[model samples]
Target: MSLPRARFDQFRLAMMLLTRLPVGRISGAVPAMDKARWAFPLVGLVIGGIGWGVFAAAVTFGLSSVIAAILALLATALATGGMHFDGLADFADGWGGGSDRARTLEIMRDSRIGSYGVLALILFSALLAAGISEVASATAFLLAGVGSRLAMLLALVFMPPARADGLGRMAAGKGEASLIAGTLVCAVLVILAGTTGAFALIGAGLAMIVIGHSATRRIGGQTGDVLGAIQLASETAIWIFLATSAH
Candidate 1:
């Protein structure tokens, strides 16, 4: 029998929110990681939608572009409970502080943040904020929302699971068809936004591929934390590219 469509939608919504969506909360009771994997991109769409709305509001308010960008960034981080930020920090700490791959992974898994991780987080966050501010166009910001999430989708497509039994492994390889469907949808959204958006999407895709390859080579596979790091890096990369392209 086919899985229920409603259930699938719920799963998608849940995966996007750091497993905090209502669909995810319900699914949490049943414990199905395979469903969660397929649902991730859908969840990304929802998150992107929220970010787009915030950007729209900022633009409508006639706030300074920098202030609008800062608000949008904060909305994303807060909505997701800084899950991706944590991943970004951990990955930075691991890669920057460790001498080898094993040590790096070990360091990433640790709860403590090192100086390298802190610096990386600060730098990345500032770059993203500044980049978004420079764009100053509602269309560009919307495209950015879509582009960043598309990067996350690409990461899921390219990376392998780092651990045997964690969330990453469960959701790693199950939904190529679903992910492709989602990417196509995101592409349409980007194209609709403008030429600049199209360029941002292309840049984000390339960055994701490069990052995925590097992460896989370094650690042999992707973890949930790696997925988070991918999203954070890709989002920042998109903003940076858009900002430069705009100038």
Candidate 2:
């Protein structure tokens, strides 16, 4: 296949996996996850762009900032079908309740939410909504989305998979190329957001790295749940940073 056509197929696979958007239909076999690894950040931008529209429209319609923030969160969630949120919850529960790798992996794979999962979701979500409450522009809101997903992609590249077979392994090959591609996308976002955007991106990226390291130490490597948790933390960090930088 031509390079552009191959790239288009990769992006379509990304959208099909990470979002609820309709990307029509593709011919032939589905692309592998690794080919689209670098495109995760781009998918986030698309999701965030829709979310920014929701937030901007809410504000324009005379809604309060808090309500607008809630709308924005809802829009993002709807777009992605809350898959990341599920991962975040599973990571929390598995780590909080398990003492070892086998137990933790088992816990994470269960389709039930435990006490730790519930608390983690509540706290992270509250912070995410609060951060959204302070989003002052479409740029900041969109940047947060790109930054968070970039964080997830970076984790996939920099960290090892906790298990032998999983999304983390299939979605990335631990190459710097994917990292560079994702970072370039994030850099564009930061440039568009100004100095504050740069600041927020730095803060968010640090938080994601920290999460990646912690997951490595705890679970021996990264898992899909860990990626989800990283995304949540990174996005929240950016929002908080944006709120602080706005001051």
Candidate 3:
């Protein structure tokens, strides 16, 4: 059965954003640039829901806080297939070890993880696990996920592409319209959930802007790896904010 045009477009864009699903079929149906521009944050909301549902279920089942947090992280990783983790590794290897832009790009292009990448991944994942464990409510967990993705959007808006090709380039210059739309949708949902998601949103936005600027200068622009790094870093930042406020 054929779907409505608008819904189909959203689904197609979501497919591109969520999974590493090939976009060959829908390549001509819509502009890749436009879809990539809007879909990233929208997919984040879906992923956030998945993470929150798992956390809520765990909480309802009388699970320990540590177990619930582990389950939530597992749910998110399964849903996104650790795409951002891969980005984090690449960014760390490139930025931490390379002596020059060409060298950094080459290191990032390498398929193997390096010492710096391993250390970065370990540290970041440990922090995430700890942060999620501190969340007392499912609402806060969900907001953290959504807020983190919004940070990713902010990164996309402010950071220059590291290269002239790849996913970052397609999404660059797409502007605030798509990001704003996604933000509004997430905001409304967060409000409906009876929590002040506004603070998380503001914190995430500020973190993204600051990090994006520094990252852009460090790498001379954004890359797919940079985008991933942004998500990973922003997610951690959001979680940190939530944890601090929870105290």
Candidate 4:
């Protein structure tokens, strides 16, 4: 296929995998998950745009900052089908409740949510909402959204898949080209937010280290749940930095 066509297919695939949005259909041969990794940040941009729109609209309609933040949060959640939230919950449940690798994997695979999962969701969701409410910058939202996904791409490229099968395994082994491409795209998005991106980048880096190391030590490598957990943590970190520094 032509280069541009291939890129288009990859973008469509990335959107399809990352969000619940209607991306129509790919015109020709579908690309592998690895090939589509470059567009992950693009998916973040789309989500951030949705969030910015909702928050702006809510605020324009005379909603309080908290209400606007919650509305924006809900919009992004709906856009992404709440998969990241579910991942965070599963990661917490598996990590907190399990004693060994096999047990952890088993817990994560279970459909039922546990106490650890509930607490994890509540804590992270609260942080996210609070941060969004405090920092009302469109640039902050866009930067955080893109930074979190960049963190995901980092884990997928740098870490091994914990299991022999699953989304992580299938999406693993992405080339450096994809990583570089995603990073460049992410850098452009972050630069648009000015120095605030520096703090957000620190947050994303810390999240990648903490989540990636813990996942590696506990379950041997990264998984979809781990990636999801990382995204949430990174996003929260970005928001906190933006909020605290907004003054």
Q: Pick the candidate with the highest lDDT.
A: 4
- Candidate 2 structure quality by residue, lDDT tens digits, 115-182: 99999889988888888887657777778888898889888887888888778768856677876666
Q: Tens digits of per-residue lDDT for model 1 on 1-247? A: 2358556654654565463444333433453555555455555566666666787798888987778778888887877788888988888887788777788788989989899889988998898889878874555555555556656655665677777765567656745664665577667766666666667777777767776787788888787777777777877777777787777
**For model 4, what is the alpha-carbon lDDT of residue 135?**
84
- Please give the TM-score that candidate 4 achieves against the real structure: 0.97
C-alpha root-mean-square deviation, each candidate: 2.8, 1.3, 3.3, 1.1
Q: How well does candidate 2 score on lDDT at residue 202?
A: 87
Worst lDDT run of 10 residues, candidate 2, spans 172-181
Best by TM-score: 4
For candidate 1, the lDDT comes to 0.70
Where in model 4 is the C-alpha error above 4 Å? none
| Model 2 alpha-carbon drift over 4 Å, by segment | none
Worst lDDT run of 10 residues, candidate 1, spans 19-28
Provide the TM-score for each candidate, comma-separated. Answer: 0.85, 0.96, 0.84, 0.97
lDDT of candidate 3 vs native?
Answer: 0.72
Alpha carbon deviation, residue 122, candidate 3 (Å): 1.7
lDDT score of residue 116 within candidate 3: 90
Order of all candidates by lDDT, from best down to worst? 4, 2, 3, 1
Worst 10 residues of 3 by lDDT: 19-28
